[model samples]
Target: MKPTSSLVWLRRDLRVFDHVALHQALQDSAVVHCVFVYDTTILDALPRRDRRVDFIHASIAEVAAELAELGGHLIVRHGDPATEIPALAAELGVGAVYCNHDYEPQALERDATVARTLRDAGRRFLSFKDQVIFEKSEVLSQTGGVFSVFTPYKNAWLKKLDADPSVLAPYHIEPHAARLAPPPSPAPALPTLAELGFEPSNLAELNIPTGMSGAARLFEDFLPRIAQYKDARDFPALKGPSYLSLHFRFGTLSVRHLVRTVRDVMARGAGGEGAPVWLAELIWREFYAMILFHNPHVVGGAFKPAYDAIQWETGPEADELFAAWCEGRTGYPLVDAAMAQLNQTGYMHNRLRMVTACFLIKDLGIDWRRGEAYFALHLNDFDLASNNGGWQWASSSGCDAQPYFRIFNPITQSQKFDASGKFIRRYLPQLKDLSDKEIHAPWLVPRMLPLDYPGPIVMHDEARKLTLERYEMVKKPGPSADQ
Candidate 1:
């Protein structure tokens, strides 16, 4: 039997169009009320002025306004979701609460608590898959077993999609939006930044677009250049990436729509060689999410258990090296510039992410977790699953990760990707006058030249030799004892 009334809880999936939870709620209930809670349990850990908070603040306002235009009301609350969601549903006299699924371990725990609370009150808590097209055991090997490697998994993922195109079909919203209920006589006003105990960040100053409209604008701008993505993405000075990660992180954009659009463009023979390559990148995102779902231990320890046996730098000297790397004073031009970019802005190029991660783990002999934590705190597009997977990949501790012996040489990486020194010079103005050749290695410049930048903190050759010895435990091929 359909419920008389229902409430839809918004989490990462913030938008209204093609929203599964919202669609299901409206279809099943005579009247529906939408809500979003500013979860303090997660927010209290963040700094006072964070770009992600600012982004959400702006984006949710747009969602509320859109709902109002559609003759629906959106209730905003600020508190722990475990308490706030059930409380709001109770106050509204909703018989059922509908929401999309969350995969992170912490999120799973919170959802469980909410579900139990709703059940105790004789109300049902319903959840559906909306974040990813395939999750859990949906995509597996021919033997119905989980695949550890990416290539084989990706092939199976593609084959499954080809067999069932309906998975990409979006959930309808307009047909059922009329079931939305109006606000009560006294509606709760949206909370201010001060009321929420957070300050405004520099997101506005950076000119970063927010909300569903912002995502649309970014996607439109990138379509013309999608063909060049494969060749141009590695160069930091070039505008190659779509720059829609922030929207993707917050669910302002739909993965289904993105895939459908890219495929349509290819069907018309418009996209170049970059089309297939970009599709593979999208698959990589799902692959990481799948890895996290099965291996919760990757959050604290290594994905490959044997990697935990390796010793990392400790004590004061290691601390000093880490500080230098964080402050962009490592003296390696590419590494310094990458760090400077991340510090100044919340975004970093994909190539730079790998370069910096490799340098921190291999060159400085620091643990990858420290670097992963730093990125998690700073990045606007930070997702725990992807961040942890990336760190493990750099440290040679994850499934299908780079070999321990394959340490990246920062100097050659800089020369190959940013040969003109344009990217490095943009972030490190002190090295602007240095020649293209000299910019990559400022220490190599003539002694007569006055340079303010510090010399290389650790020589690449010496660091490489030390790294090989440090990772000696995992050199021989063997199964993970702990796993």
Candidate 2:
């Protein structure tokens, strides 16, 4: 039986198209009201000048406008969702509340609390998977076990999709658009940044697109370059990436739309190697989500329990080095430049993420969690699962992680990826006078150093040796060692 009224709670899935919860609610109810909460429980922990909050506010405003155009209006609120969602449902006399699934632990707990409260009030709470193509154990191994390794999980994901392409199909919502209800009273105007207790950020100046329209603009631009993604993605200076990660993180764009588009291009034999590589990158995201779902302990500790025994640097000197790394003053051009980019702009190139992570963990011997927390605070595209996975991978404490002995040489990484040092110069203008070769490691240039540019903080060779010795504590026993 159709519910008399339903409320759709917008969380990460911000778009109206291909939206599982919204579609389901519309189909099952005579009238459906859509609402977004600023979610004070989460927001209270954030800074007063966060670009992410600005991005979300802008995106939600766009969504509100779009809904108005569809003969529906969005109800915006600012409070704890656990209390606010139930109160709104009661006020609207909603028989059910619908929303997309949120995989993070805190979200799960929040949902449980809300669900319990709704149940007590005789209203059903429903959630649908809208974020990833595959989630939780949906693409498990043949033995019914969750795959720890990404390659196998991705293979299984592909096979499942091959067996059932319907998974990529969009959830059409327009046909049931008439069911979308206007606000109970006069629609409240979307709140201003000041009202939400935040200041205007550089989000507008950066022009990092927000909302569904912005996502569409980015995807339209990326379509022609999808074929070149593999070649360009690793180089920090190149326009290789889709730059759609922030959209994906916020759910302004549907994962189904992206995967379907890529699949169609690959089927036409037009995307070349880049298509599959790009698809694999998306799969890696789901893989990390699954890892986090199955092993929540990874949030605070190593995936491999043995690695937790390895000691990390924690004294005043280590704190000083960490502060330098955070502030982008570590003096290694590539690492410093990457940190600078992350500090100045919330985005960091993927290759730089790896190099900077390695520099933090392997070079400075700081705890990976500290770096993870830093990224969590600063990255506009931060998802707890992916952020934790990347840090664990860098620290060699994650499943399918880089070997502890395979520490990155940050200078060479910069020289190889940013061969012309264009990216470095863009973020570290002090190195502009240095040639490409010298810019990568300016200390070796033998010229009198610029007063602003600091020398290399730690010699890579010494750091590499120290890292090896440090990781030795967690090394497995060989036959000779046993003898």
Tens-digit lDDT track for model 1 on 1-483?
Answer: 678999999999879887989989988999999999999999999999999999999899888888888889789999999999999989989999999988899999999999999999989999998878888789999998987899999999889988997888999888887899876677666788889999998899999999999999999998999989899888999998899888978999888888888988888888897777788888888888899999989998999998998899989999999999998999999999999888878888989999999999999999999999999998999998888988899999998898887888889999999999999999999888889998888888875444568999999989988888889856674332110
Regions more than 4 Å wrong, model 2: 477-483
lDDT (Cα) of model 1: 0.89
lDDT of every predicted structure (CA atoms): 0.89, 0.91
Winning candidate number (lDDT): 2
Note the clash tally of each candidate: 0, 0
Model 2: pairs clashing at backbone N, Cα or C within 3 Å: none
Query: In candidate 1, where is summed lDDT lowest over 10 consecutive residues?
Result: 474-483
Q: Residue 274 in candidate 1 has what lDDT?
A: 78
Q: For model 1, give the RMSD to the true fold.
A: 2.9
Residue 356's lDDT in candidate 1: 96
